[model samples]
Each structure stands twice: as C-alpha cells, then as structure tokens.
Target: MLFDCIPSHEIPELLHCDWLQSCDDEATVLGLLDIFTSLALESSAPDNSRPGVLAALIKHARVLAEYVQRCGPDAVTTRSFIQWILAKTVAELRMEPGFHNVGLDRWDRLVINQGESVHLPVFVPLKPSEKPSWRMFLTTSNTTQESAVKVAYRAALHTDDLSLQAMALKLLSLQLEDPREPLRTLSLLQMGMQGDIDGFLSTSLSRYLLVEHLSDARSLVQELSDLDNLSGGQSLLYSGVNPCLLWARDVILGHLLAVISGQKRAGNREWERNSSLHRFEFQT
Candidate 1:
C-alpha cells in the first residue's frame, strides 16, 4: 500500500527496493502488477511521468512472469498480464524517443520463450509510402534494419535452441540485401560467426561474394582457414576432410576464375587482378 501513497513519478523507484526484489509470494507480485497497471491506465497521470511508470510496469511484469514460471500455479495468468503490459506500452510509447532502449532484453526473452503468442506491435514507418515492419519500432536511427539485426544477433548468441537459431539466421539473411554497407556486412558476419560454419557459413560467404563484398568475404575465409590451421587441421571444419571447407574453396576459386576471365567487370582493374591472383594462390 506504500506504493499508493507515492507519486506516479516515484513508482518506478520502488521496483529497485531490496525487499521487493526478494519477495516471492505470488499475491504480492500480482498485487504489485495490478497497482502498476492502474498507474499505467490512469489518464490523469502527468504526461512527463507516464514513460517511467510504464517502463516500471513492463519490467516488473516481465520479472513476475519469470517468477511465476519458476514458482507456479499462476504462470498462465502472469503471462497474460505481461502480454497486456507489453501491448499497452508499445501502443503508448512507440513514437517516443529512447523507446527502443527500454525493456528490449525482456522482450527478446519473452519472444524466444513464448514465440508469437507475445504480440509485438509493428513499427509505424515514418514515410507514408513505407510499409510497417515487425521490430522496426526498435530502430535507433534512420537506418531501419539495425534493430532487427541486433535482435537476431542477440537471439542467435543467447540460445542453443536449433529452431530459434535457424529463425534468427533466416531473419538475418533477409537483411543481406540491404544497400547499407554496415548493415549487410554485419548480417553476413553475424550469420557466419554465430554457429558452426558448416554449410550455413559457406552460404553466408557465398552471399558476401554475390553482394561483391569481396574484402569481407576474403577476410572470413582467411579467418576460417587460420582457425583450422591453428587447431592442427583437426578443427570441426577440417575433420574427416569436411565438405564445407572444400565447398568454400571451390566457391572462392570460382569467383577468382570469373574475375581473371573477365566475366565480372573489375571495379579497380589492377586491384581486382592482384586480389584475384592472391586468392587463387591461397585457395590452391
């Protein structure tokens, strides 16, 4: 009840209390969520204070969702509350500055664990001609793809779940065609480095070549080769004469051959020729 006595602006600070953090009773948790929900829906609350209040509501809802899952008999109800809080928060704060920074880790975990059942509000594009994209609401700047890239990378690295990894990689691959150099290159590097290079990594390498990101493609192959050599040629990619390495070698060779035969136009004639020759030497 002490929360009721505090101003809405001060409610967020209550979440940091040591006593609240240690409280495990289900009633107390749910009661706190109820009080926060009321604060969130209070139209009379000052506009300047709303974001902080909603942020606390969201963070606590997420924490309670996890708590209920671990100490159950009420996880289902807790999850429903979390879903409501998330939807409400997005609806209210989608256009607010720094909106992307609040509770992203919590949202990521909820999506990973709950999947599509947790409905994330689609980002409203600034341009009328542009269509809305999921998770685009998290973009930090005019570069629309950055948030999705960061989310996919984090999700890929955070879990060993194969399906989730595949989903993250698939989302990452969608950004490979983005014209922004940094975004596309980040996607390529994340895809290759997140997991076993096996066939997946080769695909990323091939994409880099397709996109004409020659330097990055070459650097990745060299890193893989160096890693293999460092492992005394017993690394997973080299074990049993891995076909992936062979496939990658052939892909790079094919590219170099194309450049040498003038099948691909050289952007810098001398640099392309020298680079092609160096790659041929390394591959062979």
Candidate 2:
C-alpha cells in the first residue's frame, strides 16, 4: 500500500524541522496524526485492485503500528483513527473471529480489523533473509467437540466425500423444486445427527467449511434430502453459521470475493447476474 516508500521517510522533522517544530502544539500533533492516517489509506488503494490494495493497506498499517507502538495508548487521536480503520477493514474483509478459521500458516499476515492492528504472528517468510523459525507456533481457535463435529461435517462436503456422493445425489432428488416433495431433508439431517452417522455428517460439513468445497456441501445437503431428514435448506444454506456465530457467511463470502477481485468491488461488470452477489450487504 505504501509502495516502496520507507517509513523512515516519514521522519519529516530533520530537514524541514522548522516548518512543524516552529509550531509544535497539540493541534499540530493531532493534525500530523490525521495526515498520517489518511496517507496510509490513500497509499494503500492501488489500481483499486486486490493484491495492490492489500499491499498498500498493509504498508499504511505498518506505519500506524509503528506510531501506536512508539506512543503507546496516549496517542488516542491517532489510535482512535487506526481503530476505526481497523474495524472497517475487518468488516470489509469478513475477518471476524470464528467467522472462518484463521490458519496457523497464514496467521502472521497483518489483517486490519476494527482499527486495531491485529499483531498476528506473521507466518510466511517474504524474503530469504527473513525466514520464519521452526519454533512451533500454537493457535487457539478450534471449537468444542460438538462444534468440531459440525466443522468436520462441513469439511467432508467441501472436499467431496466419496462415500456420501450417492447419498447426496439421492438427497438432491428431493429438492427438485417440485410441488410434491415434502420438506424431508431436515428429518434426514436429524437422523444422521441422532444415529451413528455423526461421523459422516460431521466430517462432511467440516470439510465444506475448512476447504470451502460447496459441491461437497451440496452433496451433503442432497444426502440429507434423499433420506428425508431435512426440513429445509435454509439451515444448510448457512451451514457454517448460526445466530450464535459472531459473523455470518454472507458477509464473509462478500469479503472473500472482494479480496479475490482486488477491491471492495460489489458486482461483476462483465457478468451482470454475478454482479448481484458481488455486494456483501447482509444483516447480522
């Protein structure tokens, strides 16, 4: 986001020290903070694209991080601005805690959320000189056994579990948009939940969530539908979410799409229909 410009360059006091130091007042300090924040946002918005924008944003973030770490919490005005931007960035990126699993591998990537510089343990080594060490880094994001079971179920579906293909296909038959098909998918899901089929159900959904394999999710949905265990697809539709989850998939999906496309873009200019889903506007 800041391009190749160094933060050392931000030390504007040396040569032109008199310009600002001549009027070293609280107002001047606050004004400098505002400029820095805006410059960060501006420096990071490249071609209005993803990689470009993310890079810029990260650059700006580093600058803010330096200031915050140096001044501590006393820099409330600057800190406040940083916090505001952080929140905006998180919402824009769907980076809410538990919305999706933040991988241990990608943990170090500085993701801005809620104006706080999420001081993650940067995972990837960008330069050869800056290699990441082998000191096993630990994370604390996995949910409870019951929650983990659901996570696994989503995962299996996301990855196309071989054993459940036929079941899923059969289930799909029940959701043919036909007038005669009763809401049986819910029942089948409940059956799986109740019976020893917990492994199948849990792994399937887990796979779907972990890997984002929608086909597997669909197959699982179909599996449930065929067996008449499902009452509706609404729950299946939001498989990775519930009222309890802090963030919704709808918002996360939008954030991901924007991240991929290189902007907070809302619609596909080329494909008009896909454009509708480009916007991640949702009520939590």
What TM-score would each prediction reach against the true structure?
Answer: 0.30, 0.22
- Candidate 2 lDDT score at position 80: 32
Per-residue lDDT tens digits for candidate 1, residues 40-118, read 4442132233556556665655665566556665443342343333334333443356444344332211111111211
Alpha-carbon local distance difference test for all models: 0.41, 0.33
Top candidate by lDDT: 1
Which ten residues in a row are the worst by lDDT in model 1?
109-118
Error of 2 at 253 (Å): 13
Tens digit of per-residue lDDT, candidate 2, span 15-50? 125345576454454455455444433333212233
> What CA root-mean-square deviation does each model show from the true structure?
17.6, 20.1
